[model samples]
Target chain A: MSDLASKSVTPGRDASASAATGYRPSRTLPIVAEIRRQASRRRTQLALGFMVLLPLIILVAFEFGGGNGDDDSNGGGAFSSLVDLATSGGLNFALFCLAVSAGFLLVVVFALFAGDTVASEASWGSLRYLLAIPVPRARLLAVKLVVALGYAFLALFLLAGTGLLVGTLRYGWHPLGSTIAAQIPPGQGVLRLLGILAYLAVILLVVAGLAFLLSVLTDAALGAVGGAVLLWILSSILDQITALGSIRNALPTHYSDAWMGLLSTPVQTEDLAKGAISAIIYAVIFWGVAFFRFTRKDITS
Target chain B: MYKRQLQIVVATSDQAFLTPAAPATYTVAIDGQLTLPTLVGTPIASPAAIYWYVLGALLAVVLLGLAVLLLVRRARRRRRVTAVNAELAETPLVVTGLRKAYKDGFVAVEEIGFTVERGQVVGLLGPNGAGKTTTLRVLMGLTTPTAGEIHVFGHRLVPGAQILSRVGALVEGPGFLPHLTGHQNLEAYWRATGRPWEDARFDEALEIAGLGSSVHRRTKNYSHGMRQRLAIAQAMLGLPELLVLDEPTDGLDPPQIAEMRRVLQRYATDGRAVLVSSHLLAEVEQTCTHAVVVNKGRIVASGPVGDIVGESPSVTIDVTDVPAATEILTGLGVRSVTPDGATGLIVDMNGTPRAELVASLVRAGVGVDRVVPRRRLEDAFLALVGDNSRGSGDR
Candidate 1:
């Protein structure tokens, strides 16, 4: 390799010579690798901590407030109210945890996961290098989106699962009481809990999509996540306006609390179902905007 | 229609409130007649609301499908790390009539064309904002070209083109996670490619970087030069077929710069090509075999370093009699002569050879201490581009 001309880059420049560079460089950025990269971030740790601590914090607050332990409150909110059903069994307690945090805390969590993934890469000046590495630009975004959604789901599960564990240990695994439409069977409680959490996860897609869109729009990670959270806050404020009529239903945040219907004795899934649908709609639109903008973006940052 | 009568109906998940055994049935009190919308079917049972939802869902699915198809097509085109391949045996990079115009209506590069042949260390020579970066960006498929074409190894360059796998570039500067060790950063990068660790050729790149044990230390703790070296090593990974480096010697000490010079020379061997961008004509002079000089978004001149420097010939003479030397050199049909300090005069010989200048100087009784031809690519560069130094930053 001493001579600049006579020798060249070595064994051989032909494809037959160096046969292995991992299938090809045109491959997508591996999802597993992206997940690994993001899983170790400080914000990720902080988000997980908030998820785990939220349940215990609520439980301790319930104990101190003496929560009227009148015991009848253990019944569901007749499947209509959005208050804590913590007095119910472990399952309802988890639902209570989700209900309290869904509007804001969970929105922030989803935004953090989705918002920071791509924008942070741009901020770090690594996006160009990633593309230079020949990670097809589209593939890079796709993998980042997948990893972001995965993290969002993981955060939701952690909060819900932790609530279940702590609630079960503190309260008993009793059936949902009469506050619900009727007393739900103890055996169906776990299934109901999982269903409610799943719906909550679906409702969060709006936040995820909005954050991901902002992530594409800006190079600042804080701006992307903060913007998404701020958007949700505004939507929540708008939901309070009865003057908006059914028009308000078009709001992505409109169905945020629809999951409460899942706890009804017989379960009224209409509101929750509408909310899930709305989330998907918003997620698809926002994600579409993101992909469109990203592909056309010059990527100077 | 003027005065709407309100009615309420209660229903649960399964049973309506009509069932006496039902413990609950939530009510939706409609002050008016209920309504539903339909998408395409007959407007039968409460179809108004359904219409809106169905429309929204359909809209989402269609857009999602479009986005997915575009992305899948891009991803499906397998990314090859072609830098390690020998596919471009003769032609490594080709930029034909390349032009780049920013969104601001500023045309950074205008129809610049050049080709980097294998085994040649080509230098992208320009002052700041000369469109050097923009040209390289077009070549590497970073910034899309407004017009013209780029073909790497005979394959047309597109965003994320598979042909790019054959290129290793350190554009802008080194961008690494501050908290991660140099080795970890490289590891993460290589792993992100999903390539086998054995093919990374990490040891060789590290050796070229001369990072030694510091590779194990976090990048935030490394010096600026160290980071730059790490970036070089990064670009060198897998021993790319075409290495495009921007200011490869920037931030490097003289010894490291010399070492870099050697590394680039050796790296350019074996049919591999290296395209280095730099504003320093001196550095490019020693480090590159050919030079492409750009000025104000246009290529001013380009050719072998020897030819470019020869194009702007000059002579420097150290003499005891500055007045006499200046007088004799000025009389020798030279382009210009400026007294250099007290004892030397710089002469732009233009085309006159050293023997004629020596003979003329001896004939004039001007004691010539030393008559040496100045080998300055800068002189050639400035001669070609003129002295327009504004608006360009080494950034």
Candidate 2:
């Protein structure tokens, strides 16, 4: 002990030589890590995998049930009825698929994605460590938004791609013929497709926004995701009430039908434009509220 | 030989000696008449130029606002008197009668108040559920106190970017993205904190963490010690004025724990104040100069580490003749002599020095033996915590 003490007292030793370096306390890296983590989860992978297989299954069912010629003279048969349904610029098979995907499945997926983004960190007891680095709440929310949007878009794009592939193989990619007394030439069909994809992107953002808001309000990912989806379902049910028609326009899921306008021969731009505007407004408002609440909320629990 | 030695002394003395030089002063006299430099070629004042000036003025106002925010945050740093003086000009991080209770009204922490000096490493030592974590959360603005005010750096704890920029922390387990490599996790953390991407200090932090080439590996693969190191690394990233760590070395091996101690020591040397909470008594004893011990959500003891671990006077006498030595020590006013197995006797000298005891023992015809001071902080800490069953035989 005496020898050790003497050695410590020896002069000329540089005390700071072994100082640790590269300390960075921030949330950006953790958010990115979270994104990668969520992507690899069994449930997420399963959801994405099933989404990829859905269109093929639907197309096969359509083919086995006999082709478009099965329609009766009154357009009452399954295939012709599907065509007739498309004519209303609202309830066609294409619109049906889109509505189900966006209004229900997509909302759920987005809720799961955005809702679980931060809440998962909290549940795993990692939120304290992430916040400990002096990360401002705003920047943390921003990264979460980006990751959620990325996943939402990826899901939408994959669904759209699958739909196109199946539709082309079964009906042939001649043109996206409209039910609303419009004939889109095959040459301009791709443009309409692009417009449809863009519309879906906007619609998905609304879902993502709602999920993000729920995520910020709660620490349980399941609660946040379920809450957003429940809200979506409730809003959709409310939209069905004829007396609340005007108010229904404000519901985030109301814009799910906006892509139907893209199928018109002359391409009806009115409702599509309105829907886009509504989606943008909803996105901004939801994100603003989420950010404000996140910044102010005490994360003690 | 005498002449040569005299010559050497004269030369050495000449090299060492010097005469004091006169103080130099410079005086300048300014003319009373005011003079302006000639205007350069009729200053052009176009309407567009006026708009530009307006824009510039607006920009300057925005810039000034940003600078004020930065200054306020800097001043909020715990011990940094410069920023505190510039802003509050007095109190920095004032937590007056702070209290926090869980939803069930179970008090987790209550009435805690302490001031941290700039660049000092203060240890918060306590058993599990002692409210150290709760106290840190309140300080970081993560959890609101049930009662009382908390002023960080100098700004009142608010949900603002400026205040967070000047502080850093590592609470509980290292919350990191499992899929991300340690480096990526840190990068993401930096970006989310509103820090610039090109922060050079990040590299230094990584190096300090001893992660080396392993920083690029996913955190899921990192050992507990490595993760702890990574957490410490991430906390030190921005040279933040205030750093808070909770149970930083809970799972670390001895070497890693030592490394963490060293890293924290370096952080304090930079004039950055750190508050680290830990259950490991030995780690706190080695690293902390000041400490606050919390028990059941209340501060039981606090102050300098030396003071909290109260000094006790005892001497261990190792001699060939133990029986004789014990008898001799008892005669020297040593009230108690505890046997340390078969080899040594722990004589309670009761503030008496070894020399005096030795002389007395020698006068009594007892063979002289080696005497050593005994003051293990571990022993004192156990006593302080009221755990008498912590010694070698008992435990």
Pick by lDDT: which candidate is best?
1
Candidate 2 residue-wise lDDT, A161-209, digit = tens: 7666656555554544543544555567666666777888877677678
Per-residue lDDT of model 1, residues B141-189, tens digit only? 7788999977676666777776666788888888887768899888888
Cα interface RMSD of each candidate: 6.4, 16.1
Instruction: Give lDDT tens digits, candidate 1, residues A140-238.
Output: 888999888888888889888998889888987877543535667767877877887788788888899999999989999999999999999899899
Fraction of the reference Cα-Cα interface contacts (below 8 Å) that each candidate reproduces: 0.43, 0.22
Worst 10 residues of 2 chain A by lDDT: A1-10
* DockQ of predictions, in order shown: 0.32, 0.08
- Stretches of candidate 2 off by over 4 Å are A1-100, A124-133, A150-175, A179-182, A185-206, A230-289, B1-96, B149-156, B159-161, B194-203, B312-395
Model 1, stretches more than 4 Å misplaced?
A: A1-21, A64-85, A178-180, B1-89, B310-312, B316-332, B335-347, B350-376, B384-395
